[model samples]
Target: MVATGKKLSLDLRVIELHTQTKLAGYIKLLQNNMRKLFFGSKINGVMALYC
Candidate 1:
């Protein structure tokens, strides 16, 4: 049981890491789009909230 629990926790960690990386990539993409749309202006409140 302990081994299974450990394995499950490890799997969860891996999944969390994957999700974080995916989110980071999406944020970067959105930032790029915002920059293009705003002519390199800072990300505003609405865009920040979306990210």
Candidate 2:
């Protein structure tokens, strides 16, 4: 019984780790997209001013 419990705990830990990794990947993607959007907007604004 104790061995089974330990196995279950390990499985849960692996699942948690995978979930954390996936969430981190998504966060990084979102951050990159946001950075691009802000940078593009700034460039566009500058171009409009120059025109």
Which candidate achieves the best lDDT against the true structure? 2
The clash number for model 1 is 0
List the candidates' TM-scores in order.
Answer: 0.73, 0.88
Clashing pairs in 2: none
Which portions of model 1 miss their true places by more than 4 Å?
40-51
lDDT string for model 2 (1-51, tens) is 999999999999999999999999999999999999999999999999999
> Model 1: per-residue lDDT, tens digit, 1-51?
999999999999999999999999999999998778786454565677888
| Model 2 regions more than 4 Å off | none
Each model's lDDT: 0.89, 1.00
What lDDT would candidate 2 get against the real structure? Answer: 1.00
- Residue pairs with backbone atoms closer than 3 Å in model 1 (clashes): none
